[model samples]
Target: MTQQETHAQEAERRGSFSSRRVFILAAIGSAVGLGNIWRFPYVAYDNGGGAFMIPYLIALLTAGIPFLFLDYALGHRFRGSAPLSFARLRRGTEGLGWWQVGICFMIAIYYAAVIAWALRYTLFSVTEAWGDDAAGFFTGEFLQVSDPGVTAEIVPGVLVPLLIVWAAVVVVMVAGVQKGIGAVSVVFIPLLVITFGALVVRSLFLPGAADGLDALFTPDWGALAEPGVWGAAFGQIFFSLSIGFGIMITYSSYVHRDTDMTGSGLVVGFANSGFELLAGIGVFAALGFMAQAEGVAVDEVAQSGVGLAFIGFPAIISEAPWGAFIGVCFFASLVIAGLTSLVSVIEVVISAVRDKFELGRAQAAALVSIPAAVLSVLLFSSTSGLHVLDILDHFINQFGILLVAVVSMVVLAWVLKVLPLLQNHLNRNGSFRLGALWRILVSVVAPLALTYVLLDGLWNDVRTRYEDYPGWMLGVFGWGAAGLVIVFGFVAARLPWRKDTPMDVTDDEEVQA
Candidate 1:
C-alpha cells in the first residue's frame, strides 16, 4: 500500500474519534488537568500574590502561543512518533530525537509518582480520613518537604488510603489510552468541569470572595521591574503549556490533517489556562473568606501540600451548605484532572513505540506502563523520596527538552528549511502565517531565553546546598542535571544529518510510510 493508503487503512483499523467533537473533547481532556486546578492556584498565590499575571500574559502570548503552533505543526504534519516527527521536522540537522524521547521517558516515570500522589489524596478526601484539625493533620503528617523540622506522625488512616490511591493509577495506566485514557477522559472531563464550576460559584458567595478576586487580578505591574518575575512567567508558561515535553506531539499525531491548527491550539490553550484562572480565583476567594473568618493572612496557608486538597479545601467547604459534598466533588475533580495528564504522558511513549516498531499500541503501552508503575513504587519509599521525583523532573525538563527544542528549531529553520512549506500546507484554505516575529522568536530569541532558563534553574537548584535541605539531596539533584545534559549531548552528536524527503502529513493523514 502507498503511505497515504497505509494511514487511511490504519485510521479505519484504529478506533478513530467518533467525530470532531469527540476529538476536541479528547484534546481538552488531555490539556486541562491537575496543572490547572491543583498546581496553578498555589503557584500563583505564592510567587507574586496578585502581581504575577503581568509577565504570565506576556509569556502566554509570546512564548506559549508560538510554541503551541510549532508543536502542532510538527505533530499534525508528521503525525506518528514524537521522536520521528522531531527528527523529520528537522531532517537531521542533529539527531536530537533521542533527547525528545528521553524527556518523555523521564517525565513518564516521575509523573507517575504525581498521579499516585493525587490518587492517594482523592481516596483520603472521599473517606473523610483526616481527623480533627485537618490542617494540623496534614501539616503534622507526611509533608516533610513543607515542614522539615516537624515530626511526621504515621496515621494508618492516611497511609493505607494513599496505597490504594497508587493502585488506581496503575490500573488506569496499564489499561492503555484508547481503552483507559479515552474512556476515563470522556466521563471525567465534563464531570470535573461541572464540579469545579459549581464550587467556584459557591465560593464567590462566601463572605470575602471580592477580596480574593482583587488578590488574583489586581496585578502590580511593578512586578515587571524584577528580572525574576519575567523568568517565573516564562517558566510557568512553558510548564503549563506542556509544549516541550513531547506529549503535545503525541496527542496531535492523532489529529486530522485538515484540522484547523490555529483554532485548535487557541482553544486548547485558552480553555486550559482559563480554567486555571477560575481555579486561582476560587482558591484565593475561599482563602480570603477563611482569612476573614480566622483573622489570618492568605499567604500563611498556601503551602504546596498534597494534604492541602484534603485539609484546606474541606475547611473552606465546611462553611457552605453541602460542604462535605462540595469537598468530595472538588477532590474528585482533581483526581480526574490528574488522570488526563498522567494518561497523556503514558500515551506519548506508547504512540512513539508502536509507530516505530510496528507493535500493537496495547503491547507498547504495557511495556511503558509496567516499568513506570514499578519505578514509582520503588522510588517513593523514603518520606523524603518525593523530592527525588522533583529533581528528575527538573533535570529531564532542562537538559532533555530544551536541547531537543533548540535542535529541532535550528534544523527546521536553518538546516532542512522546509518548515515554511509544511506550515504553508497547514495554512492552505486557511489564514495566518507563522510570520517573521515568531521566526526570530524561535530561531534566535527563544533559544537564548531557554538557555537562560536552564542556567538559572540549575544554579538556583545547586545553590540550595547551603540551605537546610541536607547536603546529599543537593548533590544528587545538582549533578543529575549536568549528567543528563552531557549524556544527551553525547547521543545527539552521533545521529546522522541528511536531506530526507519531508513526510509532512497528519497521523490521520500521512507523514511517512
Candidate 2:
C-alpha cells in the first residue's frame, strides 16, 4: 500500500466528532459540572460578592481561555490523546500526559459516588423523605456514617445507585466517541440547562429570594484589594473550565482538523460562566427562602458541596410550595451534569490506553471502565467512603490538577519552546488569531497565579489538617494519594508504547484539510 493510503487508514481508525457543533456541546458538558451549581456561588460570595466578577472575568480572559487554546492546539495538531499528544510534542513530555490520566483516575473513583448520591436524592426529593432532619438523614439514615477509616462494609443505599452510575458510564464509553460521548452530551447538556433554568425561575419567585440575591451580590469592593480574592478568582476559573486535567486535550482531539478552536473556546468559556452565574442566582434564591422559613439570616443557612445539595436543599424542598417539583429539577440537574463530566473523566483514561496499546474502542473502553467501575464501587460504596472522598477531592484538586497545570505550561512555554508553533496551529483555521498576548498569559500570568493558589492551599492544609481528620487518615488519603499520581505518571511514561504506534506527526500528516 502507498504511504498516503496507510496514513488515511490510521486517521480513520481514530474516530472524529461528527461535526464542530457536537464537539462544542461535549466540551460544554465536560466543563459545566457539579462545581457550577454548588461551588461557584459560594466562591463568588466569599471573594467579593458582585465585585468578584471583575477578577473572575479577568482571570477567564487572561488565563482560562488562553490555556484552553493551548489544549486545543496540542490535541488537534497532534491528533492523539494526552499521552500520545505530549509524546508527539516532545518525547520526554509523555509523563505529563500520564500524570493527567492518573488525576482523572483519582477523580473518577470518588466522583461517581457524588453522582450516586444525587441520583438517590432525585427520587427522595419526591416525598421530602428526610422529614425535616435533612442533615441527620443524610449522615445517619442514608450513608450511615461510620468513623473516619477505610472499611470493607458497604452502604446498600450508596452501593445500588453507584452501581447504576457505573453501568451507564460503561455503556456510553463502549459506544465510541460520537455515538456515545457526543450523543450523550448533545442530549444531556440542553436538558441540564432547561431543568436548572426552570428551578432558577421558581427560586426567584420565592419570598426571600431577593434577600438571598442581596446577600450574594452585595460586593465588598474592598475585596478587590486583597490578594486572596484575586487568587480565588483564578482558582475558580481553572477548576471550573476543566482546563488542566487533560479533558480538553482529549476532547479536542476528536474534532475535525479544520475546526475553529479559539472561537469554540470563547463560546465554551462564556457558556460555562453563564451557567455559573445562573447557578448563583438560583442557589442563593433558594437559600433566601430557606433562611426566611427558618427565621435566620441568609448566611446562617448558606452552605456548599454535599451539605448544600443533600442537606440544605432537602430542607428547602420540605418547606416550599411546589417543593417536590423543585427538588426533582435540582437533583436531576446534578445527575445529568455529573454524569456528563464523569464520562469525560473516564474517557481520558480510555483514550490514553487506546493510543498506547493500539486497542480497538471496545477493548480500550472495557479495559479502562471495568477496573475503574470495580475500584469506584469498592472505595466509595462503603461507610467510610465519604471521609476518603472528602480528602481525595481536596488534595487532588490542589496538588494534582493545579500543580500539573503549572508545570505543563512552564515546560511547554519555556522548556519545549512550542507556544509559537501551537499558536500558529490554532490560528490556521481559528476564527480568532492568537499573538504575543496569548503567549504572555500562558507562560507568565497563568503559571504565576496558579502557583500562588497551589502554595496557599498547601500551606493551609499543612498548618491545619484538612477538616481535622485523623493524622493517619490525612496522611494516607490526602498527601499520600496526591503523591501517588505523580509517581504513576513517570512510571507509566517508562512503559512500552505499541510498536506500530505513530509517536510523531509526519510532515505530510501535519495539516489535514
Candidate 3:
C-alpha cells in the first residue's frame, strides 16, 4: 500500500466518535451509572447529610475533575486506548494500563448480573410480584438463597435474565464506537434522565416526601468533625465520577483531535454529581413514604446498595398507590443506568485486547465477552451469588481500583512527567485554560489523598477480616482476586504487539503529536 493510503487506514482503525456532542454523551453515559442511582444517596445521608457536600465538592475540584482531565488528555493527545496510550507515554508503563483494564474486566463480570436483576425486577414491577415480603422474596423465592460458600447449582431465574443483559451489551459493542456506544448513549442517557426526572417529580408529591428531603439536606454539622465523614466524601467523589477505571481513558481515545478536554471533563463531572442529587431526591422520597407507612423514622427503612434497591425500595413500591407503574419506572431507569455503564466496562477490556492484537471490532468483542459471560454466570448465577458478588466487589474496589489510581497518578505526574504537556494540550484545545493550580491539584493533592486512603484500607484489612468473614474466604476471593489481576496485567503487557502496528502509533508518537 502507498504510505498515504496506509496512514488513512491506520486512522480508520483508531475509531472516532461521530461528533463532539456524541462523545460528550458517551462520556456522560459512562459516568452516570448504577453508583449514582443506587449508591450515592445513601452514602451522603450516612456521611452527615448536607454537611458531606463540603468535602465532596473539595474532592471534586482537587481530585475528581483534575484526574478526569488528565485521563482525557492522555487519550486525546495520544489517540490510543488505555494500553497503547500508556505505552506511548513510557515503555514500561503498559502494565498499569493492563491493570486498570483488568480491573474493569473483573467489574464487568458482576455488573452485568446486577443489571440483569434490574431487568427482571422491571417486569416484576408490572405484577408487584415481590408483594409484602420483599426481603424474603428477594432472598428465597427470587434467588433461592443457598448458603454462603456453598457450591450451589445455577439458578435459572438469575441466569436467564443475565443472559439477556450480556446479549444487549454484545450487540452494542459489535456495532462499533460511534454507531454503537455513541448512538446508544444518545438514546439511553436522555431516557435515563427523563425517567428519573419524572420519578423525582412524582416522588416530591408523595406523603412524607418532605421528611425524606429533610433528611437528605438537613446537615448534622457536628458529624463533619469526624475524619471518617471526610473520607466518605472523598470516596464517594472518587468512585462516582468513574475516574479510577480505564473507562474515561478509553472513551476519550475516540474523540476528535480538537475536542475540548477541560470543558468536557467539567461537564461530565458535574452531570454525574447532578444525577446523584436527583437520585437522592427520588430514593429518600420513596423511603420516607415507607417509613411513614411502617410507622417509623426514615432511617428505619433507609438502606444502601443491594438492600436498598431489592428490599427497601420494593417494599415501598408494594405499598404505594399505582405501585406497579412506579415500580416499573424505577427499575427500568435502573436497567438503563446499569446497561450504559456495563458497556463501557466491557469496552475497556475489548479495546485493550483489540489494540494489542489488531483485531476487528466484532472479533475483539466476541473474544473478550465470551469469557466474561461465562465468568458472570459462574459467579452470579446461583442462589448464593450475592455473597460472591459482595466479596469480589469489595476486594476489587478496595485494592484493585484504588491501587491502580494511586500508582497511575504517581507514574503520570512524577515518573513520566507528562502533566505539563497534558495541561498544555487541554489549554490549547479547550476553551478554559488549565493553570498552575490544576497542576498542583493533580500532582500533589490527589496523590496524597489517594495514598492516605490506600494506607487506611490496608490497616483496616489487617485489623479485621472485612465484615468478619472467615480469613480463608478473604484469602481465596479477596486478596486472590487482586493478585490474579496483577498477574494478568504483567503477562498481557509482555504480549507481542501486532506486526503491522506503526512504530509511531505504538511508541512515542503522542509526544511528537
For model 2, the superposed segments whose C-alpha errors exceed 4 Å read 1-4, 506-513
Model 3 residue 466 CA deviation (Å) reads 2.0
| Over 4 Å off, model 3 | 1-7, 503-513
Tens digits of per-residue lDDT, candidate 3, 280-341, equal 99999988888888899988888898998888878988888777767888898989988888
Using lDDT as the measure, which candidate wins? 2
lDDT of 1 by residue, 144-241 (tens): 33332212333343344445544665566556545566667678778878988887887888887777666666666676687777777677777677
The window of 10 residues in a row where model 3 has the poorest summed lDDT is 504-513
How many clashing residue pairs appear in each of the predictions shown? 1, 0, 0
TM-score of each: 0.83, 0.98, 0.97
Cα misplacement distance, residue 420 of candidate 1 (Å): 1.4
Clashing pairs in model 1? Answer: 77-505
- Give Cα-based local distance difference scores for all models: 0.63, 0.92, 0.85
**Candidates ranked by TM-score, best first?**
2, 3, 1
